[model samples]
Target: MAKTSWHELPRGVRDAVQRELGGVAGVEMISEGLSSDVTFVAETGLGRLFVKGARLDDDLKARQLRREISINPYVTHLSPEIRLQVEEAEWLIVGFDYVEGRRADYSPLSPDIPLVLDLLGELSETPCPEIPLRDAGRLRESHARPEDLHRFSGDALAHTDLNPGNFRITSDGRAYLVDWARYSRGAPWIDATAFAMCLMTCGHTPYDAEGIMAALPVWKTLEPGDLDAVAYYQSAMRSAWQPRLDPWTNASVAAARRWFDYRVGLEVGL
Candidate 1:
């Protein structure tokens, strides 16, 4: 769906929310987002907050909300507070305490790289009963090729979409991950490889031997045939990239394909 403006909310829905939470003094439309409707800042008597609204009728929107709530607590170590949910007339509105931060252009390569890796590593380390293993398998199945499907049918949870834009870096230099809709359990190394590949695709040199080696140490320990699966998944992901969507997305996908092909040959003699 195309991006929506704050004024696009149904009059009844907007009125109902105002009645319940008291009149909103201001509402500003944010960027042109792909998944959900985003508002810059919504002012209330209580405080200023970021508002994200989705059509209640859309099943995908509803599921994304539930996913956000489910994973928010588990990832508190990463960022800003997850606000309460406000359901108003056919709309699911979620308010998050806006964290002041900027999106980093490239994945922090030195200290921050390992920090992000460790944070992601910890998520895969512990088992969460709330996150069903089946969901992970389903996601991998949807994204992986038939030949490589078996490798991703594991019991580990992974943040399937780990990119710079999805992360926020606070003034104090803390990284907070946003966008939980794509979080699911699956092959652990896939997340790390996805992150690295994404970085490389965004004009960062994460494909170098040193960078690959850094991730390989962690990736190799996660599962059998992990490296092979990572390369395969990277290629698959790049193959699906649509240049018409966005330039960055297009470049990343193209770079990931080449990087994976080169890495596969160097590593497995394939």
Candidate 2:
């Protein structure tokens, strides 16, 4: 998606940001993420802020923006704080306190692995706030067995997308999970499972990924068949959703299949 430049935004939107931040000194556009039409960091008189938004006319993006804004309060401790919000007839923009960090590396030997696991441990213990969030099983409802969907139910709040880019590792080894657009209410192990998938994508085999995830407390509470059910559901979901011809989607599908097959092999004592 081509990012809309700072000047391309409506005058009303620009004015709102300037006024809210006191004054804007400079603007740096961020081009990595595809969810936002306008994403940039504004150097303001107050401070630098990470601003992201989409036009109100784009229903999907608009809803995602609103959902992200609504979930900010609940996740502020582990994520950035929402510093400003601009809602006009044509646009909805949100600004978060700029976080200085590097993208987390999920490779097999990266030291960032432990920091990521610790973040997940904290996230698993976070209480699910009372807000409208999608149920985790909805992603697998069309593919999972009817009897197994209940296994995904729990009061825990999970960041369902555990992609490495979504994690920010600070210089001091603190890990911050950003981008709550896909957050959902689900069992505590949902995050651990997602992290395992991410590890697999970064060259960790299924057994190695599971071994890494074992450090998280949530990964220890699974019943006899929980891992099998999650792996099966994740594989089914990944296979069903890889319509886009992209490297990321292709890699994810292959990784999920590997995980599901590994679980199945374990079941048969292979």
Candidate 3:
């Protein structure tokens, strides 16, 4: 593989992998997550494999690498194939059988919206064996404020970043959610709301409040108090970050800020 700077990788961690996994025939950096880097294909003597890399210094990234390897065995038959785990100096490397898929586009919002929602539901319902619930306190320390904790609801594995680019749509129409570094235990609605926020940010206004309502019917099942908790949690989360996200992701964050302020009746703007 050709040596490249870290920033050249879409996910920003491929340089570390190439340095450690030498003689890699081919390398394609795929997605950069909040904490980890992903490559669509990495060449090994045997064959090409999907690889993800992260620094051990990032607690979340390190934990997620371990989680992917641990949970992968149980879900291999149920979901995608997780191949192996290789530890390279200062970096955790994970390999998976390459799944053929393409990024979903934002045009024709009708089907994609519901499709992503269904994908999240399926992932959340998958049988995870004995993984600890994500520490809400730790997340609060990383991104939330004190008031955010009071709004905590039930916990489940949430794909915190669900922007359109993060989803891969196979030719068979199966949707795979990649980039697991931000995977955390949180209210299920957080993912739904985050998805909704992304859609709106991408200029797909065809789905309005009613569309968000329809996709996440779980909100209706919640008691009035529970609904309040979900709203606060989502609002606080929507406002939690101001860092430099991927170029495509910035619009989504701005839209989320607008929606959050509108809902909470606060002037907080991104």
Candidate 4:
């Protein structure tokens, strides 16, 4: 889908949002969106809000909307606060508390790296709520060697998609994860594991990523061979699809493969 601008939103959407927000003074299209929706920030009489909407007929997009709605409350402080959800025959929309900032720089030289790691540390401390989240293992269950799938299940709540664009760093120097579309129940290290790969995609070496993730409780306790299979299957799944979706997928591909190789070496007693 082509990028959606604020001006392109349906009048009903604009009206419903304005009614909820008291009144809308301005609408600015935020171009940093990754999903197929019209995402924008509206300056309202009450306050500024981030709003995302898509056609109700788009099944996948609609499910993603519901997923965000279902999971955001469970992962408080990790995602933007959702103010209201507007559902109608033609559209489904939700508005969030507008957060001011840019995406975190995962590159080696960037100071934002530590801030993201710090945020993850804090997030790791948030216990899982009772909501039923998708199992993380399901993503690669078919491709995974059987034993790897068992390692992926757990009680910890994870914001499974930790890609750079999915999180932003505030001007005050804090990291906030934005997309909660893939919220899942899984082993805690999987979050750190996925993030380590994200770091590698941004030019950090696998070893450098390891240093950042080394202190997490799950990472500290996981057995080497189990970690290997999980990392290998996870990365391999990403390598299969990400290349077709984004131009920079190779960096992620390399990073995930490198981690997989390291774990494989450990398994073989090398």
Best by lDDT: 2
- Candidate 2 clash total? 0
List model 4 lDDT by residue over 1-270, tens digit each. 576676677777777877888888988886656664788888887688888887888888888888889888866576688887888648888888888988778888789877877877877788887776788777668767877788888778788788777788898888888888778888777788888878777877767788877866667856656667767785767667634556457667777777787767766877
The order of the candidates by TM-score, greatest first, is: 2, 4, 1, 3
Each prediction's whole-model lDDT (CA): 0.66, 0.88, 0.58, 0.77
Q: Between candidates 3 and 4, which one is better according to TM-score?
A: 4
How does each model score on TM-score?
A: 0.81, 0.96, 0.69, 0.92
Candidate 3 C-alpha lDDT tens digits along 1-270: 332233454342444445545546876765544445444467865467777666677787688778767656544533467655656556677777777777766554456555666676676576435676575446655445554554444565566767666687777777777655455666555566566666667765523742664556544444444333434445555456566656655665566555554555532332
- Predicted structure 1: lDDT: 0.66
Better of 2 and 3 by TM-score: 2
Using TM-score as the yardstick, the better of models 2 and 4 is: 2
Candidate 3 CA-lDDT value? 0.58
Ranking by lDDT: 2, 4, 1, 3
Which residue runs does candidate 3 get wrong by more than 4 Å? Answer: 1-40, 43-47, 55-61, 74-79, 88-90, 107-110, 141-151, 205-210, 225-246, 264-270
Clashes of 1: 1
Residue 19 in model 2: lDDT: 90
Error of 4 at 12 (Å): 2.4
Against the hidden true structure, what lDDT does model 4 obtain?
0.77
